[model samples]
Target: MTCGRPMFPGSTTEDQLHLIFKVIGTPTDDTWPGIIYSEEFRGYNFPHYRPDPLINHAPRLDAEGLSLLAEFLQVGPTAQHFLMVAISEAVFESFGAAVQRLSDLSSLFEVSGISLHKNPGLRSSATLTGRSRQGR
Candidate 1:
């Protein structure tokens, strides 16, 4: 857990979804299959939001924690699981090496037809880590 508070603190389902979207951005057709078929969602037009940096919401986390959190927060279950395995194997690597491994994994996922935008948090995490380790 990055912060000691709930990530999405909305009491109602709709409100909670809005909160989630505020952080992770709205799901597109590529991200959510059959979403168009939902009558409830079909009538509602959700605002398009760019995914925010996890550090913006969870400033308590360090680069390593943010990197791990980013991997676990991928859109689809399969992507999340895949990254989980990769992250587990990366545990033995140094912080810089692990971040590089995650970047490589992101490239691999994209090459394998997974949308790169599906994991903006990872990109943001990597960027932040790079900035923190400037000149290293």
Candidate 2:
């Protein structure tokens, strides 16, 4: 029932995130507001995470190839669960494609449990999207 939360930093993030620190190659501000993540201590913060190289897939990687990628991600000794890239689609048909692959992706993530969600103030079921509910 939780809408996976919107990252919503808007254009500011798009602009500021890649900005090099005037003094250094990194940013002067430790945090950039509107960076979407699960961290508390609400304030300015930038993307501070990196995928485990051993556990990550290069862009455009396919599902089966992602299996070994996920394994490497879960390979650390600690029981900590790391990150998974968020994937979104535009319409109901696209959503259908996402649901179809959820299993294989879950297997790659090495967990049986997952929940598909969307932004709040939106329908929980795919049936309510766009023109369907609008009668347009």
Candidate 3:
């Protein structure tokens, strides 16, 4: 759901992956800061209708986090070449279906350096790419 997701050009959802999270002390119902957004495309149709569940503060990596993540991916610990591009993104449900299938999710997470660690079960799930984890 996170990787391989692309948006239609000019789609209102495009480049919106790094959404602004609500401030920790802010009220849930409080109005947005009224920042100027590139005008919404009311007439536009995302013919491929999708739902949006934009979560705040999407998990990401800093230089340090990336080093940690890289070690987990086993592609190497100094693998800074990838995290800068993958770390920061909102990944709303809008992009899920188009990019989903058992294989893509596993592959994406592998690239993201998020294999199950510490969980005894993960030893197997680590090798179960292209398959959902639930069934195991």
Candidate 4:
């Protein structure tokens, strides 16, 4: 859903594809570098449609909110703005407080020598069982 309405609501895949194109339109080198060279994007047989503005698609969002959302929704992994930049740009009234709190927490975590990296097997049942047994 763009805001609340379905962006590509259809019974068939074709209809959905059409709607998808309508919303995003075509991605060019300027908008998305190297997209034209991707296997899926190359030699495609589809109708070209222009992109509808984010506001037009999601009328409920204000310009600032939409700008932030657009940054987050970039197609390329590197195209998206950094979290810090996005937050600063959005500039919530409590941003300073939030950043200070985060910094304090990070310092505490660093002093404790606890790595922030997530354990790859965290979701496995075996890991949970082992941890539970250790607690006993």
For lDDT, the strongest prediction is 1
What root-mean-square deviation over C-alphas does model 1 reach?
Answer: 12.3
How many steric overlaps are in each model, in order?
Answer: 0, 8, 1, 0
Question: Could you estimate the TM-score for every candidate?
Answer: 0.53, 0.17, 0.18, 0.47
Q: Give one digit per residue, the lDDT tens place, for model 4 in 36-121.
A: 78876665645667777878766666787678666655555565345446545523322233432345235323322222332365
Instruction: Score each candidate by Cα lDDT.
Output: 0.60, 0.33, 0.30, 0.53
Q: What tens-digit string does per-residue lDDT give for candidate 3 at 11-57? A: 33432321212112211112223212324432322133222322222
- Candidate 3's C-alpha runs over 4 A off are 1-20, 23-35, 41-63, 66-107, 110-114, 117-136
Query: In model 1, which range of ten residues has the least summed lDDT?
Result: 110-119
Model 3 weakest 10-residue run by lDDT: 18-27
Candidate 2 whole-model C-alpha lDDT, 0 to 1: 0.33
What is the model-wide C-alpha lDDT for candidate 1? 0.60
Task: Kindly indicate the candidate among 3 and 4 with the higher lDDT.
Answer: 4
Ranking of candidates on lDDT, top first: 1, 4, 2, 3
- How many clashes would you count in candidate 1? 0
**Model 4 spans > 4 angstroms off:** 5-18, 82-136
Quality of model 4 by C-alpha lDDT: 0.53
Off by over 4 Å in 1: 77-80, 83-136
Residue-by-residue lDDT tens digits, candidate 1, 4-28: 3567899987888788888887777
Per-residue CA lDDT of candidate 2, range 1-136, in tens? Answer: 1123321223565444323221112222223323234343224454444433321223334564355334323422221333232332232233334333555336322322232435455444222233232444
